[model samples]
Target chain A: MDLVNVISYSLFAIGSFFLVVAAIGIVRLPDFYTRMHAAGKSDTLGQSLILLGLIIHEGASFISIKIFFIILFIFIANPTATHAVAKAAFLSELAPWKKDGGKER
Target chain B: MFLQVALVIVFSSIIALYRAISGPTIYDRVLAVNVIGTKTVLVLVLVEFIYERPEFLDIALVYAIINFIGTIAFLKYIEKGGLT
Candidate 1:
């Protein structure tokens, strides 16, 4: 009914949709890296939007400031975490998805 | 409206948790857990409103940091053959 409600609802819906997309990407993607691509990038954005909505709903307060801190932490950590996982996978010599005859254990 | 959005986020969290529980590989499970953590952050903020508590945001902030550290540690453990 109010502006805050409208904005928060929209943000939540969008965030939820993005999260669903990430889930689908995980289920459908053929390899670890591709799955990470979906989960890491889209989910991060989804979280940002959802947090923004919550911050709005909360209005100006100490909590809003803490939410900002959460946002900042996510901005720094999500991508770095994704990178770390990818690097570990590569270093572990896990064979990527193969096309034809080259596939091996 | 806020309630609806929270509902959607909760739905997604359940879906993500399912994936994590059934994931075939450790990485997939980790990915699912990370997604769940992101959702949890949002949920925590929402709960602050429902409970009329400002301090919960501090909990959310701490969880975010912990989740990040946990992810990094898991990755390192996977790479190094053991957690150090």
Candidate 2:
């Protein structure tokens, strides 16, 4: 309806779309690395956008501050978690999916 | 509108749960959990706004922190063979 509402609505729509895409990627991707790729990238942006939309919808309040902090924490921690998983798999000698039909381990 | 979006997120989480259930390796499960945990946070935020409940925001914040810590801890134990 208003500018703030319009902006928040669009944000929600976009964020939800990315979330779905991430989910699909996780389900449909061939290997752990690729699944992590989808989850890591899309989850970060999608979740942040949703939270940001919430803040915008709610206006300036203490709740907004709390959500803001959550956004910051997610931005830092989510990627760290993703990288840690990938690195651990690499160290463990996990084989990747190959295009020659050599499926993952 | 917020509720509709939140439901959509929940549906996405359900779809992602497929990976956790049938993932070939442990790390894939971890990845699934990580993605689902973050989505849960978003749902909580939307629930708070939709229901006019302020306390849910607090829970959502704590969940975000705990989710990160859990993921890191799992990875550490797996990679190092011990938490230390």
Leading candidate by lDDT: 2
Residue-level lDDT for A34 in candidate 1: 76
TM for candidate 1 is 0.86
Candidate 2 residue-wise lDDT at A74 = 91
Model 1 per-residue lDDT tens digits across residues B62-83: 8888988888888777768788
RMSD, model 2, all Cα superposed?
1.3
Error of 1 at B33 (Å): 1.7
Those runs of model 1 whose alpha carbons end farther than 4 Å from true positions after fitting are A99-105
Could you give candidate 1's per-residue lDDT for residues A1-105 as a string of tens digits? 999888877887787788778767766676777789887899888888888887887799777788888888888888888887777778777667776735322
Candidate 2 Cα deviation (angstroms), residue A21: 0.2
Best by DockQ: 2
Residue lDDT tens for model 2, B14-82: 999988998888999999999999998888988888889999989998998999899989989888889
Model 2 DockQ class: high
**Which candidate tops TM-score?**
2
Every model's DockQ, to 2 decimals? 0.59, 0.85
Local lDDT at A75 for model 1 = 83
Clashing residue pairs in candidate 2 (N, C-alpha, C atoms within 3 angstroms) = none
